[model samples]
Target: MTALFDVILPVFLVVGFGYLVCWRRWLTEVAVDGVMRFAQNFALPVLLFGAIARLDLGANYNPLLLLAFYSGALLSFALGTGLSFYWLRRPIEDAIAIGFVCLFSNSLLLGVPITERAYGPEAMLGNFTIISVHSPLLYTFGITAMEFARARGQNLSVGGVALRALSGVLHTPLVIGILGGFAMNLLTQAGLVMPEGFWAAVRMMSSAALPAALFGLGGVLYRYRPEGEARAIAMCCCISLLLHPAVTFGLGRIFALNLAEMRSAVVTAAMPPGVNAYLFAALYGVAKRVSASAVLVATGLSMLTVWFWLAALP
Candidate 1:
């Protein structure tokens, strides 16, 4: 219990601080945007590269664990989308957005830091590996989900869709950083060595990534207020916090993951919805309300859900 409190309180404190700053108008949307841009484009990439460069990828690679995690995510995505479509009676696009909110989590922002704090820095390698496997699916299938929402009755363009899909991969700093790190790791394995100063610089830059990300998330929460969309947002949060994690936990057990790994997987599964869903919805101008509501709802409720899972775990 003490460990759990130690882990959870800092998160809420940061979030609360963000909420207060926003409420006081001390952190404007413009400031939030600038912070997000820096975190996404610069700091996060350095963090990713540094993480991957230092990983002992050859020995630690667990194909079965990766398969189980990805499979669980895919199943969760399908189940979330199908159930939302059936229950909500909404358009495919809106359903897709809600479903996405149910499955895709703020793994990079919240998952990394929390897991690192709970399990230590070594856990980050497993976390990043899971993220790398999910990134392609997120880029391809995730964009398709949004496009489905936005296209409505219009005829789909294969060429345009392909270009857009590829663009998603090329534009993501996370993906770029992962690839760059993998390349460097390969070179290092073959006997390449960097000067001490260069390594120190990379370490310095990487250290800033987590705090910046958490603060950016807080700033975003300040800007996001559910307002009139409370009911819909609540529904989305219920699915994201309760149903999604429950299903993932069951799957993890069925796959016979060890207790520690199972707990980690559950925490990862219970993460709040990704903010990228809102960004994509805004970019495509489709189901923006649902996307925004999901972000607000999932983030607001995740504190409780995370605590519950942590307590429930051994």
Candidate 2:
């Protein structure tokens, strides 16, 4: 309980401060957009690079741990997707949006900073690994799901879709950053010398990423007004905050994860609905209302859910 309070409460306090500022119109929408653009294009990439560059991905890196986390995430996403389609009887696009809402998480925005505070810098590695492994899944299968729903009657070719998907992954700053950093690490492991100046610059830039990302998230939430899509959003928030984490906790224990790793897995699983849901919705012309609503509700509720998880963690 003490651990939870100590670890999670402060994060909520900071996020709450941002929300208050935006709610009061102290931070204008223009300001938020600029901030998000900068964070997404620059700050996040630098952070990913720096974190991955420093990773000692040698024999000690646990493939099983990565597999466990991936399996849990995949199962949760599948269950959510199936439920949204069958139980809710939503249109394909809306179902895809709900599926992503349940699956993808704001691990970068919320996970890294909070984990660093709670468990230290080393814990960030777990998040880095998870993101790296899941990036391909998100870019390919996730986006395809959205496209399939949106282009229900369109004659979209498989080859064209594959090419576009590959291009999207190649163009994404986050993906590039992860790959770049991993490549750098590999080269360094093979006895290449990274310039001190480059490392120092990346380190400094990366330090700014987390706070900026959080503030940007707050700004996005401010722009999102939960007027109509309340029911769908609420359902997604329940699944994300409750069902996902519960499953992760059970499976993590079954995988025999240590306390630190289990905590990391649980917290990651409990992360807010991803910003990507909104992005993908716009791209695929899905249930934009529901996607936006999910973002707002999940982010708002994450404060409470995170607190609960922290409190529950041993």
Candidate 3:
């Protein structure tokens, strides 16, 4: 219990502090937006770049681990979309947005800190590996689905849809960082070494990634107050917090993943929908309320759900 609290509370407390600041009007919404922009576009990307650049890709890039985590994410997306569209009677676009909420977990903000606290820095290999392709893969899938849905009865061709999806994925700051890191990694393999001073600057920025992002995230969620769509919100929370991790766990066991691999897969799978989830909805102007509310509600519920998963993990 102490360990669980240690792993979870500090993260949430920082998030809570940001919420309090926003709730009290200590910072304007514009200020909060600036903070998030800095964190997401600059600090967090640099962190990913550093992590990926220094990663021993040959040793840590486990296909089985990736399979378990991503398979669960895709499954959750399908279920969330199908249920929202068919059962909940949402518009096709809205269904796609809600599915994105289930698809993109808070892998960086919540997953990294919790897993690091529970295991150690060495365990980050799996997390970073997953993160490297995470945004690109999921965003591509989500965008393709959304474009297809939107393009129905329009004159848009299949190639046009694929091109737009690919364009969107490539334009992401996170994906740019990952691609740059991979390029750097390759250069390093070719006997290139970055200077210590350069790394020092990278570390400085990387250090601010999580705290700044988490705090800004709280403020962002404050704006997205839980309004209507109670049923859809509840479904998103369940799928993101419970079902996704369960599927990852089952797959991990089937693949005989080692303890570190299992922990990384399940913990990352278990994170609430990321701020990106809401961003995706906002970008498309569909189901924004549901996406935003899911991020807010699911994050609050993750405190207990993450603990349960940690305890249940082998």
Candidate 4:
């Protein structure tokens, strides 16, 4: 317990401090936005780029890890939807919303900072592997699910949905980081390395990512405090905080992922539902209240679960 505290406490301290600052109005919303954007858009990308660039890409990359991680997510989604319809006596639309919340995680904003803090910079490569594809895949699943949940007989244009998903993939910072780092690593493998001076500046930006990100997480929690249906909220908590990570750990073991890879898969799976889960629900015009309630529930529960996963990591 002492050892675990030594590892995970400082990160939460930064998070709590950020929460306090925001609660006290020590920083304006605009200033908070600036700090979050700096960390999210710039610092995170740079850190991911550097970390990925230095990796032995061929050996380090593992597609099966993604499979294992998503398998758990899909299971959790199914469980949430099942619980909604059968037990909660909710509509199918509400079930869809519950499923969506259980599936997506706040990997970038919360997961990255927490994983980096607990496991150090190297574990970020594993975290990056998940973050890179997180949005694009979830976006596709989210859109399709929402479409089905609402009305159930509408036809979405395949080409249009594909285009939108592709566009999102192209614009995400995680994708950019992975691609850029892979390019750099490719060049290094061919005997050309990045200039030391250039890398030092990248490292400087990278250094700000964890602290700024933790602070930004606090700000985000303040920004989105969703409220509605306690039963739906409790369902989200069970799926996200308990079932998701448990299943992820099982899958990781079955896939024979290394310790670092296992830790990455389980830790990320344990994070709270993405804030966009609420946005996705809002956009689809289905289960908005259920989704909002789930977000708040998952966020509150994750403060403790995050520590459990970090400490339990192999």
Candidate 5:
């Protein structure tokens, strides 16, 4: 019980408080979006950067764990794509979107924060291990798949599409944070000490990242409404909330992940679909309806499912 209160209660309380206030009109949608952006673009990067720059990351490195994590993610992606194409009879573009909806975990906004709150901040190192590759790999695959779908009727250059996809990877703030932090870590390893004041400033912003993210998450839920085909939304939610985590856990065991890695991987897998998926869908003009509905449904229900998984974790 003490562990429950200490580990899990704080996370949900902040999230519930965020929802309550948003529902009560204490925070506007614009305000929430601003806070989310502030956290994602600036605070999260600083926090992650400081983490890598200061920590002795080599002590916990696990290449096998990464292999296991990716195996699970790829399996989920393939399953979702197959189901979307065959079961739902969606177009190629929509099927890729469905696969991404399953594969792209909300690692930053909800996964890292919740894992930190539940297990402790060090758990986030494992998360960083996962997120470092998550975006670049999955986004590239999704974009390339979408490009191929778009090629059916147009004179689309595959190399050009691949270039655009890679550009997206470069432009992502989280990826920049990982790369920058890695460079700093290398410098630290080479005997360059990070300044006390600079670390402090970054820490200050980093401290607010979790709370602001939780608030923004709740606000997003409050404002979100499901539309379009209910069947598609339901299928995507199942893949996001259930199948992904199950496969992650199974693969973790098979790949012999340590306790921390297993927990981190499974928890991240269980998080709702990334909110950015809707943006991609909207931009590409495919699966927008299903993506929007999936985020809302998976996020809302994850309030319960997340806790269940945390409690179930050994």
Candidate 6:
């Protein structure tokens, strides 16, 4: 009860406030777009850069931890894709888009803040470890899959498709931030020290990342109402909120992860699909409605599901 009130509700309250303001027409779409642009393109990338630049890669990058969390993610993707195609009769393209909803978790906005509130700042090393590669790995995989799905009967070369996927992943702002951080870390390790003002500016921007992102995310969710595709939405919510974390938890135990690692892996796996799910679907013009609705519905469902996972985690 205490954790539910103290740790979880505050985060959702911010999100809810965003939704409320947008629903009431107090905040216009243009304003929301600007806010999201600033958060995603600037603040959040700065946050990732600072965190990764400071991280001790050797100590924090645990293979078992990565395996446990990502194994669950891949399993959910495969299961979601297979079920959507075989049972739901969705097109191959739509099925891959839906599978992406299952694959990509909101590790940065929701996962980081909630984990920080529930545990502490230090416990976030594992969370950062997962996030550093989250976008690159999943986006590459999702884009490649979608490209292949679209390329069938279109005379597209496999090599060309692969290159396009790689190019898209490389150009993402988040991935750019991560690669920059790695470069900085390597430079600092070699005795190159940056000025204090640079770090001060990084801190300033980093502080605004989550609050702005969450509020922007709320307004974005408001735009994606649950109109139709009830069954597909339900399946996505189940896979994202329940199955992903369940697999991570089981694998965490199997891998004998420590308490912090267990919490990070399970909680991150439990996050709803990020807005990128919608963006991916929109990019390819497939399953746009289902992807958008799944993000909104699964986000609402995650409040209760995350509380349960928190209680269940040791």
lDDT of 3 by residue, 144-171 (tens): 9999999999999999999999998998
- Model 5, 252-283: lDDT tens per residue? 88887888998888889888887877777877
lDDT digits (tens) for residues 1-314 of candidate 4: 65346655676678777778888999988888898888867888888788778887666669888888888888988898889889998888777777888888887767776776677878866777776667768776766665545535667576666666567656767567767877888898999966799999988988898789878767756765667578888878888888988988988888899988998888889998876787677766777877876776677677788878877776
lDDT of each: 0.73, 0.76, 0.94, 0.78, 0.79, 0.95
Tens digits of lDDT, candidate 1, 7-106: 8678667767766777888878788778878888888888888878777787556675566565656666676677667866766766776666666778
Residue 101 local lDDT, model 3: 99
Q: Give the CA lDDT, 0 to 100, for residue 169 in model 4.
A: 59
Error of 1 at 12 (Å): 2.3
Name every residue pair that clashes in candidate 1: 93-149
**Number of clashes recorded per candidate:** 1, 2, 0, 0, 0, 0
lDDT of 3 at 271: 98
Work out candidate 1's RMSD over C-alphas.
2.5
What lDDT score is found at residue 297 in candidate 1? 74
Per-residue lDDT for 73 in model 4? 87
Candidate 2 yields a Cα-based lDDT of: 0.76
Q: Model 3, 256: alpha-carbon shift in Å?
A: 0.7
lDDT of 5 at 147: 79
State the lDDT at 275 in candidate 6.
98
Sorted on lDDT, best first, the list reads 6, 3, 5, 4, 2, 1
Where does model 1 exceed 4 Å of error?
148-163, 229-231
Error of 5 at 53 (Å): 2.5
Please, what are the lDDT tens digits per residue for candidate 6 over residues 205-254?
99999999999999999999987998999999999999999999999999
